[model samples]
Target chain A: MTAERSRLNLRDLLSETAVALTARPARTVLTALGTILGVGALVTTLGLAKTAGNQIVSRFNELEATEVVVSAQSTGFGDNTRSLNVIPWDAQSRLERLNGVTAAGTVSAVDVGDDLARSVPVVDPQGQTEFQIPVMAASPGLFGAVRASLFTGRYFDQGHEDRADPVAVLGPAAAQRLNVTRVDNLPVIFVGDEAFAVVGILADTARRPDLLGAIIIPNQAARDRFELGGVESVEIDVAVGAAELIGAQAPTALAPNNPDQLRVAVPPSPRRVRSDVEGDVNALFLALGGVSLLVGAIGIANVTLVSVLERTGEIGLRRALGATRRHIALQFLTESVALGALAGVLGTSLGVLAVVAVSATREWSPVLDSWLPFAAPVLGAVIGLVAGTYPAWKASSTEPIAALRGVA
Target chain B: MRSLRRSRGAPTPDDLDDGPLEAWAVPTAPAGGLSFEGEAVPVVVLHQAGRTFAGPPPVEALKPTDLVIERGEYVAIVGPSGSGKSTLLHLLGLLDTPTAGSYHLDGIDTVTLSEPERAGVRAARIGFVFQAFHLLAHRSIVENVMLADLYRPGGRDRRRERAVEALVSVGLEHRLDATPATLSGGERQRVAVARALVSEPSLLLADEPTGNLDTATGDQIMALFDDLHGQGLTLAVITHDRSVAARAGRVVGLRDGEVIEDRLVGSGMR
Candidate 1:
């Protein structure tokens, strides 16, 4: 009977403490709001940061190299602003023929008329846009250097090159734009009034900007038909040991157009870019998430302190009723922790909403991806836990008797 | 001690023994009364004990006075307002430490115990009934009673049963689940009594327990105290009413922190 009595006492104390919190719920809720906003702000910021990081990673993948880029610049050829590449076919061929070089490829900036656009988005009333996608056109052996595989049709060969066949492979971005749109063997106009046949559509690559509308062609065809009769630029793909060696001869042959365009490089594997982009995105998320968590802590602290004051008489009663000092402190702190955690949950949900909002509007491929819809909740949960800690601590430190006597 | 004896089934005027028992009311508990070897006793001995409040000018609220209270005795320490009545109660309750001398409760030297130990002793041995009732507004009547047992080890169901039993003892079974705020002034005091007795303390102490109640209600509460005394609990009460003091076995009148009269009522055989 005696043991039963004491046990009942503890249960009653905790229940009563919780009850005390509920009595001034309006005030408690008001205090809790601070934590909510703090957590929400943090989580949403984290979402944006993650998106920015993914954008950067995707950007890196777009620039993924067969060899480290020594430099880059405009092609500077006359009347070629609409051209897709600065690196011409002859320069790439010459670079590839070097002893230590494995292969060579080239890329350029091009403005393709929106192939599938009913209309352009994020533009002014003039019908012009700031969105310019990266376009790469490669020589015959370039595939060997960049390690890209053809999804269906074969990569360009010498016969097509010699005849300047104009058969082109569409990159992932272009393929997505033309998803099941059935444009195989269709005539597509390009630089120098060339008419090209769409051989195959490339899947969307994680690489952004450059790989979006990439158009690949063999060297012979590029040299015979597309070359503007000079060194447009050179992109050399050399062995690791010979990266610096290409620097020696790069200025000699291509300096006229290669002012900064002669890019001597070592290629990165596909896997490296994928993981790197994910890591970058996560780092950005953590930075923003951390800051918001601090806000949550402050919110929790304020609420707790207020509660301590409001419940002063209640605390005094508990003390008189057999509650120890430590018990009082623990009870208040526990309340704080609960509030912080609830706020965290709310904040995380807001963050997920942010990601959803972004996904609804922008067409840019996000670098970091979550599993279909559920990943948002997981991300939110993690952010919430991190943000709720300090608030919980602050809540737990209230002195029981003083807390009881404080006005709500 | 014979004057402190009860007439068993018939409650007598001097049956209640008041001796440092009021502090136990803070707990809604069980076994607040003292016990070690299957028996309980109330033995308070205050020797030259006093308290000083550290204000801008330190106020000596209580004067050193030697006192002793035997087991099963109902004693009323009477005094006028601000005549050190509350101060003496606080000191007896162990809620405050004395600035001088020493005190003993149930043969245990209080001055020598650790702070936490003192708290444990207070929890285990005292039941207090305040003039204001001081019931926690948030908890139900049963919960309030249960709080006194918080330091006592047991399971939930057992504690719950004891809480109900305590409420029944104070005739508050019908309002077991009602919060103090929902109770009337008299009912709240009854709940407070339930909370105090739930702990079954060695000493039942009252600091003007009926001060907030009307005359009839005050007398009813006093009668309730008289009935508890018949059950052999030690009680110490502080009151301004002469009639309230008249109900105790021994009445000690205080004038300016000094005991002016010590009188016995009814049978003073022991």
Candidate 2:
């Protein structure tokens, strides 16, 4: 015959795909469900990982990134004796003068032997009302360095430190133990034979929470009464991104002559911490997404293969109508790809919704990569293509005569 | 004998020319006058064509046989079950290749053609009407007819137009938008006929076209075939029903794996 060659165009392929898929709406939706769940999980897990990682890193940056601790190195003795690294009494002022240092302070524990603290002047020989509370000597700037908030009264100032006053600030635990609730009356507690006036009761400290249970006295008062010697540790609070700088400079600022005798502890870099956390989170979530996607792909493949088997007569008819094997393959492939792309769109929407819903419930800002929504459909299409490969081939290879006879 | 004598005359390109492409037209030189002899080639020519299925002991399905069918002729192949009727039909439709001999359709050697080339030839020159109707149930009558042209090489501009015309010719114009599910058995067969004719193929091969229809519907379909034959189109119908076979101008009867009888019936007019 003087006829043009038989061929199938892209438009016809797409139209045929549409007709085949829409012919059974319920089957189409059921077949696509696997991909939807898979892609949805992928997006949700990835989004949640990013959002939670951001929260953790921001909190870590706030506290760990800004606090630096400088402690005197012990001389490898059995006791808590330091290596003569004298942090001078003016150490707080010296360290605070450095750049990025918000506040600085010195703290030392006073050794009290067989002495107990009591709310009343009588020394209870029965020891029922007497308590053996550890005593702490701290500079006035310690309150600021630790970010402590007061309960009612004010903090002991430099005047009290210089004049060697007996006024004391009780931690919450110490106050409760001593039966002192209000600081407005300036309650006094007797330590051994000394009556120290309670100046303030601390509600909370940001850095060292242990200070909440100890009875804190001025550095000079502790030195004068309890014979306190070398300062134990210096706490310095610096600005964000300045912990390493302040940590390196604080030891020298405290003891310029024997700076080597002081040990500085700086928090790990925020960038490293953030990456480590994100990497762990991404790996775990990506694996979950990958597994779900694999299951989705298998669902597509299994359903497509079953469809091909069920439609052998149709395939045979097409072949008899002058469709080449390639035409048959393309038709089925196009159908599956369309199915996958549709599922991808649905999965992405569901995933984004899940992320937003969870974030809203938890009161967190949702985080998602902008490209995710755009790429998900394409990825789903690719999965469909791969999954449809064998089925399409099976359809294309069906023998026209055998299939028409219903033998295949 | 007249057709055989007339086929010897060399037909010129002018003799091959006809009216503008329509739903039905008797092709003068369907294969573009591929025969260098310049003579009118028969629509089908078989030289010892046969099919055999491989088995522990090979089974000869259709023994080597020779057959010829000329243009504008209506021929019927009838036989009981397992009579090699299906083998001959498959061979003629180009659905199966012959292992014993050669087949030439519309002056072109079919055995040497590649699979894709055979498919192209089938698309352009042969239209098949299955007894089952084989209409796509999900599609409208018009769309089912239009699909006949989907594999044909051409711009899609006039495809729907040709399909509508074919449907109209088959008296299905009013039911263009109706699906096969909504059609009777006879109406569906007519739709199948329209789809087959939409391509304007050189040969129409029907496999028991009335097998799935009632007597009245079968008669109606046969009457449609009579009209198509009156228009000088080539037709080949395979069936086991003697009544259906009696309508064709020529009948070839098969028994087992060989043709047992070939005869003319009715007016035997081409």
Candidate 3:
């Protein structure tokens, strides 16, 4: 035989294989559905899980890659053990001013703002647009530490903090909601009593990408409006190269070798309980996804075995054609992989569609977090191959002559 | 009666030259009595071939068959139902294992062949036809014929051409695309014959090729077989049909697992 014929033989074998499957496509598709759906669910869920997991990691990285956040004892008896409480803003400011130290800041969570909604009467050619933004506060240098630079206006200095000016810097979402051309000269109504002018507008970034309507004010001005009695969360930064030296200089009274992420509260607060609930929900879905993958495998096995039985004569014909056992097995495995890949691509599209639909309906821009698109189809293909192997093995081992006679 | 005389080596009148002449009878050696020419390669040699199935007190399907067929001679094996005709064909076809025997097919003893090796021999050296025309139902006539050599030493186009040539010999060239089911009983049998011939095997062993057709149709298939035989193809047709048996130049008849008759038939028998 010519080399061309030999090289082209495998393609013929595969084409024959595909044609054989196509002859009874309804049954074949029925057989493959479970594996497809199972693999689909597995891959799609894994995609989402990876998305969520990297989101939390990004959030952790968002705190600052090189710095360690220092926490204090709780204000009361119950608080999250993992939650980093208030670190005394004055002490934090002093640490920032230390030699070689970069900027540091304390974070204050926006607990239920009482009716001080950001109101803007935005006018377009069609009609007027109105939206509201929640207000939040942060310590001085929060912008510098978080790297939220202004696009149009300047950040509040010590003067604004001292004077308690009715001024605010707008986040991207807040600017968008106000329908404003520029935050430099726009007035936004705040609460039932007053209107505040936007001093600065935050720029969009990948680090903390999505936008939610909100206004950030100076910590001093915020204290006048709301109580800063409980320190919700804290963030700190170390100088470029002083992390090790500073850790060593800590008082010997506190054991230096012990890990520093110590959460000392005996009981958890409502916020801690809420985060726990969210974690449980995530775990529950992940567990369901794992079980569905297993069910999908069983489905694949069932279909493959039945398909082999149905195509017993075809198997004999192929074997009689000088196909080795490995060839038969590889063919079936290839078919399974193709089906699984198809399902995975379809399932990923469906999942993304589901997320997009939710986002559109809820009016919340859900973060897609990086790394999910590449991981989905590969997982689907692997699952398909593993699930199809045993049945294909059984098919490959069937005796050719007996198969011709249609004997078991 | 020669009484089934078998000598290990060639039993000859040469022993009379030195020893007592009474042990063997020979007046003057007849000039070249019963001599075979060309290669004495023993294309098939079965030494004490035995096969016994372990069922209902071990039914022995084949006895210790000591037989041989020369390279280019058409030999017909005739037997009744369960007379071991099919079993003997299988053993010679390299499709079954002998419980005890040295079956040397074409100078290669098959007792030592692996399964794949046995199948290879079956594919390359022997072709078989079944009574029911065991063609793949799903494929067309040409494809059915082509399958015999699809995985053999050729490309698909060449194999297809060979299959078409074979089909043409049996006069089914016009029905290449028709499925076997669409062909008549006689035509289907011809297609089966075409399939067996496609591989160009050294031996063609057909089991009851015309047993299922009418007299005229049966005669047609037998006529085709005869035509192939005249073309110098060595063939073995297994059947109880007297006419089909009558067509062969030499017929070896089996009764109760033993050769009961070996004779040359005349055209009047058909």
Q: Name the top TM-score candidate.
A: 2
lDDT score, candidate 1, position B248 = 90
Best by DockQ: 2
Clashes (backbone N, CA, C under 3 Å), per candidate, total 62, 2, 0
What are the per-residue Cα lDDT tens digits for candidate 3 across A1-408?
A: 001111115666566556556756776666556555654554445445544444444443423444544445443345433234334445345556555446555556544345445456535658545344566666656666555666677777767877777677777777766654475455665643556666778875222332235677766666666544444333445454454443333211122334253322111122344355446545766677667667766776777778778667656655544444665677777777665655556555666666555556755454553555455566566767887888889888876555654631
Taking all chains together, each candidate's TM-score versus the true structure is 0.61, 0.68, 0.60
* Higher-scoring candidate on lDDT, 1 or 2: 2
- Each candidate's interface RMSD, rounded to one decimal? 6.5, 3.0, 9.5
- For candidate 2, write residues A1-408 as lDDT tens digits: 433456898999998998999999999989989999989888888788778777767676577778888888887677754546467888889998999999888888878777899886457676578889989999999999999999979899999999999999989999889988887777889889788999899999998888998899999999899988868888888998899888888888888898888889998787776677778877877888898899999999999999998888788778888899999999999999999999999999999999999999999989888898999989899999999999999999988887787722
User: How well does candidate 1 score on lDDT at residue A315?
Assistant: 60
Give the TM-score (vs. native) of candidate 3: 0.60
Poorly placed runs, candidate 3 (over 4 Å) = A1-13, A47-143, A146-408, B1-42, B153-157, B178-181, B185-187, B211-217, B266-270
Tell me the lDDT of model 2 at B102. 91
Q: Provide the TM-score of chain A alone for each candidate, in the order shown.
A: 0.42, 0.62, 0.48
Model 3 chain A poorest 10 in a row by lDDT = A1-10
lDDT of 2: 0.84
lDDT of 2 at A202: 95
DockQ per candidate: 0.16, 0.28, 0.08
